[model samples]
Target: MPEIVGESLAKRLIAWGVDTVFGLPGDGINGLMEGFRRHADQLNFVLVHHEEAAAFMAVGYAKATGKLGVCAATSGPGAIHLLNGLYDAKLDHVPVLAITGMQETSLLGSRYQQEVHLDRLYEDVAEYNLMITNPQQMPGVVDLAIRNALIKRTVSHLTFPNDIQIAAVDEDPYAHPAPGTKPVSLPNLDRPQLAPGEPELRAAAEVLNAAAKPVILVGAGALHARDEVIAVAEKLGAPVVKTLPGKAVVPDDHPVTTGGLGLLGTKPSEEAMEECDTLLMVGTSFPYGKYLPDPGTARVVQIDADPTLIGLRLPVEAPITADAKKGLQGLLPLLRGGDSGFLDKYHKEMESWRADMKALQDESRDPIAPQYVVGVLDELAADDAIMTCDSGTIATWSARHWTIRDRRQYFLSGNLATMAPGLPYAIGMQHAFPGRQVIAYVGDGGFAMLMADFLTAVRHDLPVKVIINNNNSYGQILWEQIVLGYPEYAVRHRQPEADFSTWARGCGAYGVKVTKPGEVRGAISDALAHPGPALVDIDVNPNEPPMPGKVKYEQAKHFTEAFLKGQPHKAATLATVVRDKINELRS
Candidate 1:
């Protein structure tokens, strides 16, 4: 058979080191599926339950391995389904390439079935978008899509019409050129090394050296520069405040580490930010400006590879547009050691904060505190475990209770703050690193959104442990309404309480439901020990709110107003809040 465009595309992806493709097959891409079959030995196609899950899996894969993640779909709706996940990748700045199918060339503008203009649809989400109309455009388009996705750290897209997918290529796209003609070389996939200039480094160091109390804020951008960030923090005696995505950048047990910032943060972190005279932001434009120091209160130095993100969230006195690792390396040598007093203060505060948190993880709680469940997992999980979290109150528990140490890595929908990616992300991480343990820390509401994909894990025999905080309510939304002085409405699950464990068992996976606090640890331990996919549904107290680090008077007033305004479970919520505060005092 002649070399078709689909075959050439598959071959090119193999050449670029893409071993797996996460997507569902459809008639629109029947030719492409055939090509994938021909190269099945070299490339693995992960058949996902939904196109959205496929896109999220690609995002998860890219986030885990720092490589180009690829996902494909059919035309129209399949292509439309990829938008949310693609947007997640775009906002998080992860590299993902999306391939879709188009209607046949003859059907162009004929209003045929599944005839969607994918190029215009993807224009906003993709860094590079193209629709291949000719067989000759195959090699260059594929190369450019992968190249742009990697270099720009965003989504790239390509759509091929059904007729064009199987069309024969007339010439060798990768062959050596004739005399006086240029050769077609594959695009380099490696990212270019970028470091701050000497002047920029010196300027940043000067600001650091001049400050009496400096706080280093790290984000996802600093994930690969852990050592460099540590060196800088130690040299400057700065308290390390992590953004949620940067939770693993520094171990929670580190002397200067103060846990995460913003709503899902520790008191020490908030205090450090409130008091710091100089702020050094690494690879994060943490969006909550209220959580940061006042605009002119502190001098700021930010290091990021994306120039567009520098000084975005705060005013910066020194902006270094370079890779986090390289920028920190250059800035470290010029830094002068500051007094250890500031770090010492926060270290003591962190100890108190941790003690208070430990008090809340009481095993005596009847409904089983979510904190207790996560704390147990933290104690039992492997040193190199990978954690994928869903958005909502579960994120609160994971951020506060899970201590990331050693080789443990955490992934979440940081910029998008979307739900349902937890399970899909876990599946992707398990695929990327088969030997390492992967767990999805998701809430009941979030897990319900994508629970069908649990079957994917079972089918593949990927042992992904899922720990669900089964509160039977939209816990985060409930808390948000209360905090805003509004009575919670339609937040609680109206239907019969979902027993996720039974569903897991039906899907041919290990399953357990833990209602009592005493059962939490054992259930989690067993799930982790299972050889295949397992799910643990632990019923937790829905009334327990994820309180902010420092609850302001306004928030307190709102809580009172919400209760007075006839919020459901008002008595239970007030009791829970009061008990938690008393526990904090006792600690």
Candidate 2:
């Protein structure tokens, strides 16, 4: 029997070094499932509870390993379910390939069962989108889709009609090739070695060397250039501030580092940005313009692989278009040793900032503080662990409290800032590094969105530890409402809160619930030691506010107005805020 399109596509994926595919099975893609079955030894299909989870798993895998991530879904609604995760990949600039199934070719334009136009639906999200109606499209289409995803660092999609999926190829497309013609082959995965020209490097160095106070801002693009970043920071006497996704680029305890910058940033970081005369942005296009130095007040030098992002966020005096690693390497030698006066100032501020943060993690609080929970996890988690975080107040705690040390890697929905990727990301990270420790730090609302995937962990024997900040509310939105001068309306969770620990046990995994501050550490320890998948549901104080780095006058006034206008739990919120302020003063 000749090779079928589905089999050919499967073989092509394996040839391109895809060891696993995440998806849900359905009748719409029966032929593709058969192909996956035949290649079971080489390619493992991770069955997800939802197509959205499968797409998120692919994104998590791609972000963790820097390899092309692949996911599949059936036609119509299954394909529609992939939009959220695909948009996450697109916004974060990760490589992902989405494979979808379509109705039979005979049903073309008939609006048959599950006959949704996937090509049109995926247009905005995909860098390359195609529908395979012919068996001969085979290896060529698959190869192109993978290449587009990897090369562009974005999403690629392909939809296969049911009838065409099983059609046999009559002839070898590679056989009897014309002279000087090369047959379709696996794409080259190595990134092109790109560096800024000597003139550009020298110009950027001049801006840095001339400034009396220089600050270095790093992002996810700078992950691979840790040493180079440190060298430049040291030479310029600059404090290194990271974007959320760039948290792991420099260890939290590094001498030149000053944590993250933004709403979820540190006081020292915000100060450095405010006082700096020159801002050096590397590998990141940090979207929040408010957190950056005022335009024209500070000279900007930016280095990134994408030329379009060079001056996209802030005004640039010198823009170097090159990979973060190469750009930093070239500029390092050109930089001259400068005064340590600027860095010394922030070092002292960082010391006080650290003390204030430590004070906020008081384990004596009756209702467990979310800060305390994260601090304990930071202390107990393995040095080389992989952490995946969900959006909400959990992001603020993770950003400020969880210190990235040693070989630890952190991944989150940075640009998209979407919820529900936490558990799926951990699952993907566990699959990528089978023996390494993987943890998902999520909020009650975010976890509850896709809690069904906890079974995916047990079924696959993936040892992923999940820590839930069980506040029983949409805590972030609640605070946002107060800041916007509106009373909290629909942010609270209904009565009879979910018992996630019980849910974990039902899924055949280790489960622990901690209600008091004292039980926090032991529960976390037990969950981490459980050997298999585990979940820790810690009932934290819902009224505790995730304070910003520096509170603005307008925010304070609006918060007060909201409280007067009938914010729920206003007394509890005020007490917690007062207690934290007192601790800060004492520290």
Candidate 3:
């Protein structure tokens, strides 16, 4: 039995459906790069200025195509640089293979240059981490990483020690071939239901039967039984209100669907959730618990895929452990249809909320409405286009305002909330889904954080159109300073004139700049028309506010600082926002 080493790893990479790899080839890992060069016919290598962007690009690709993404880096600093994006992948559950080179196997513990314990460092952030110590373990390790990335739906890692790459080995590709894809369904477990379950279920139905205001809170879990979820909502004459992760669970324009609810959510969703006494949270978990009004005072029922979640965060008067689809189906027959009063009350509130939301477009005066820009993008994007949004206020914008429906896809780093990640991910997505349009919306601040990678798109001719929201500052942080009673520190940046279009032309691609609201549609048209990579840079209004949230200003400022200052997993900031998301649709 023979085995492969460095070049063989590259071959196995292609066998596992990896079409591209992003990373820099440094002194410690030139052998893998050489292997990649020989197999250039089957694989493409994207070069970026930093390893962080490479990891982010991989994340975007997975989000868009529903396939495993691959990113690599040299030893030491290069591998360390990937931690930021690695954490991002872990939190979002994006499948990624983060490969890195290591020092000579003999030198690993000798404090040699570029030598570090790669496996231990990556353990917490990766679903599985491995150090390829032998050529015999080559293909098996490679296959395992890919399977973990896809099956666990998480970040997986592999490290190649310098000595092993140059060591003598065999060349059997079948030592381990790629595995099959995993099922999308979450696991069903056996757990006990609360005592008041059946009674509470009927009581919740009574509220649904009796109330004039009823809104259904749809979470990401709805993806499993979309048809059943829609059927249940329509049968009860309830409007669907979603959480951030559940943006696309229900159609945005569905007469029975309200948009996302959060800091960047719309008044319609807020009014429906906050004012409605009878709230049904089904198939998802809303982390912002504090935002949810006390269930004890209101009629609250929870239907979760996992039984543990039934009463995990807040005590659900009604907790159903069955699949949301199964539970909803079971409960519907027992529900007696109610009068028009509750539905009419919710409808009235939704109408007023819709009017207030509509007024945002009326800010058609200069600087351009960021809200409308997002709206127009939603309208112009192809039916199947995959959109990736950066973290921060722009993330809120997409979650709250983007016209995502049951069929559309909108990817966000909702759990990790990293900036400057959307562009790189867009490039990877374009490679994975060559036929589908891939669009990325990034704030000026976030874009600059990884600006150089725009060239990576040009080099590969990955025709991704980027919408740069040029607000000239850290817009969200600035608002926090004002509201939180802190002087604006590090929030403002010099209004730099970044001629992305000119740069695109220089880079052998396309670029368009729009300064007003009217120009957005035409620019988007021009971008979609262009043959290759292009960017639509729009000067957005910094004052365009988010939908709504309960985070205090001062706390928000410190939270942003913790992220920008390199403190990953700082609980104090994220803890506040992680409250059980109360999808108490006012409707």
Across residues 59-160, which tens digit of lDDT does each residue of candidate 1 receive?
Answer: 999999988999999999998998889999999999999999999989989999989999999999999999987777767678778888988899999999
Q: What C-alpha lDDT values do all the predictions have?
A: 0.91, 0.90, 0.71
**Which parts of model 2 are misplaced by more than 4 Å?**
171-190
Candidate 2 per-residue lDDT, tens place, 273-325, comes to: 99999999999999999999999999999998888888887889999988889
In model 1, pairs of residues that clash are none
Off by over 4 Å in 3: 1-3, 11-16, 34-41, 168-215, 275-283, 298-312, 316-344, 405-407, 495-497, 547-587
lDDT sort, best first = 1, 2, 3
Instruction: Please tell me which model should have the higher TM-score, number 1 or number 3.
Output: 1
Residue 283 error, candidate 3, Å? 4.8
How much is the lDDT of residue 1 in candidate 2? 57
- Tens-digit lDDT track for model 3 on 1-587? 22337778887888777788878778767767877887899888888888999988888777666667788899889999998888887776568899888988777788898677889889898888988776667666777777777765689999888877756455333465433433323232111222225665676566666655556787755555566666766666666777776777766666666676766666566666766766778866677765565656456677875565566556666666555666777678776664545555655666665555444543344657676787777777887777888877788667655776535777777677778888887887787877888888888878888878888889878898889888777877765554444445676566575656676677777887888788988898889777788898888766554526345565566646645665422343233223212212221
* Pairwise TM-score winner, candidates 2 and 3: 2
